[model samples]
Target: MRGMKSRLLTRREMDDLITKPDLPSLIADLENTPYREYIIGAKGRLDGILCIEAALRDNFTNTFRKVQDFVRQEEAERYIVIFLHRWDVQNIKTILRGKNIHVTSEEIASCLVPAGEMDEATLNELLKQPDVRAVVDLLATWKIPYARPLTRAYPEFLKTKDLAVLECALDRYYYDDALASVNSPGYNNQIIQDILRLEVDVINIKTVLRMVRDRVDPEEARRYLIGGGRVFDERKLGSMLCLSSIEDVVKTLANTPYRFLADLPESSIRSQKISIIEKELERFLIRKGVGAFRLEPLSVASVIGYFWAKYNEVTNIRVISRCKTADVSPDILKEELVYV
Candidate 1:
């Protein structure tokens, strides 16, 4: 894990990749990096942004798999498994969203990173289901735990045709299960718990911003809130829900560790560019995860740190690839990236 972390691109190397004129040049530059083998193999079967993205996803999945394989301590492996379950949640969300939009199964498959309990074969099977309902039914037939939440939420999803209904259900289940897994008392479990709570807070913050932007009623939005947040609890989140605008919602975070959300430019706040806020929040979590590296070098903190660092690297590469495809200026592209 330390070796993998050491291979992450430095700020200068990332800048160099960002300044590449086009996709091919970017691919050429990457050939000299750790990503060379995966990118080269992907380039043969895919083209343009898809090639770069596929390589990034494959590399990330393989790296995480190696970490899982390398860890031998039973307790440590359990924590790692809990951390990796998020990927299963994410892959399910991707498939559901793709099915909702009527996209081809291949497109959905391209977006998945099977780094969780659900292997590539399992995901492929889910992709073969005809539609959203079929996918849920298949999961239930297979007795996957996620099937419970999806099955319970399916009725409302059918009535409203709203994907958020199902997505929130998955989020609630995953967070609930993760927190429970780390409920036992230990320094390592505490580390994992803290990270999970921070994640819950991040998700809740994004949920608030979305509700405010869409003008959803406070009471209605309450149902979407996930529990176990370290900072904002039910009452605090409820208060945030009643806030009038994005700026007001952000201001509520002012005295907390997330005070930087309120520090963003007035223009960005006024324009309601939630993506900017979301990116900053994501960077905040990445920083927290990376900081854990030194907290307990031999414990779960190192694992958490390496996971986030790798995730951040892959995400930055993907952003650069997409921006290059669109001919976005280097200056503007830099803003879109989340550097910890």
Candidate 2:
């Protein structure tokens, strides 16, 4: 709202722009290898950033199609726009990481979303540049000022394997910015706030759990806890830590919205099996997001719903692909799958 001069699509406007005719046409266009073409469109337009359209066309063909029917997409587009923002940032995140660690340019290139910010030339150039600092510099030309945060934070992010710090910074910055104007006239979108709260909360909880398991000090663990997720607020997290066993953990969380995971009586939890809990909770979030999208189809709710689904699709495909590439057993891969 502060810096972006471009118009954001209103619910009514989104309804008009994305129609039945538009959906199938967009979907049809996505059939082949348009990823490169998307890269082409997104690259030089770094300032205006058409990556959102690219992402919607590339990754969200089904969602775009469903919405284009004009009956279902208004809600989908709410997030359809923002998800483009988020996933684009995420792609830049991974690419930056790969570049920092000196992962191959080709290898890094293969993982791009082509819909977010990076264009092929700039991304290629950034990848070819020496390190993370160069990547930050390459993105310096961006009109949306938030890219500066990553540029500034690279040193600390390098010192700590705390990629989440950068990610969390981006996350908090994004929602804080997106939700800042929610109370303004003609813009009463609370669903974005609510769902984002849950997501951040889940991430904070997972981070705290990982830190504890990784043997980071309690003080450090406390430091790592993000202050405000729907589930893991400071108070909730304090109570959660007092529980000794995973059963106690499950039961303590049983009363909260997250209690859904505990409803599965047979799902056992060993400390080492915490990833299982993480997976189940994540799937629960996706399912919940989908339901929310259906309920509030034309608002920010639908956008988030489609966003979550698209993310799951991309992540699932990546997981399956990586497993296939690694020649892992189906049994093991199944264990790692989120089943969303």
Pick the TM-score winner. Answer: 1
- Window of ten residues with lowest summed lDDT in model 2: 1-10
TM-score for all models, in order of appearance:
0.97, 0.67
- Residue 55 Cα positional deviation in candidate 1, in Å, after optimal superposition: 1.3
> Model 1 over residues 1-340: C-alpha lDDT tens digits?
6777899999899999998999999999999999999999999999888989889988988888888888866567877798679899999999999999899998999899998989999999999988999999999999999999999999998898899999999999999999998899999899999999999999999999999988899999998999999999999999999989999988888989999887799999989999989989999999998888888678888888888888889999999998887889999999888776
> Residue by residue across 185-300, what tens digits does model 2's lDDT show?
43225676667677777876676556545656555556546554665667777656554556666767777887776765455565446777788778877777655645544455
TM-score of 2: 0.67
Clashing pairs for predicted structure model 2, backbone only: 19-68, 20-68, 43-119, 67-73, 75-297, 75-298, 79-303
Least accurate 10 contiguous residues by lDDT in model 1: 71-80
lDDT by candidate, in order shown? 0.91, 0.56
lDDT of 1 at 97: 93
Candidate 2 residue 222 C-alpha distance from true site, Å:
3.6
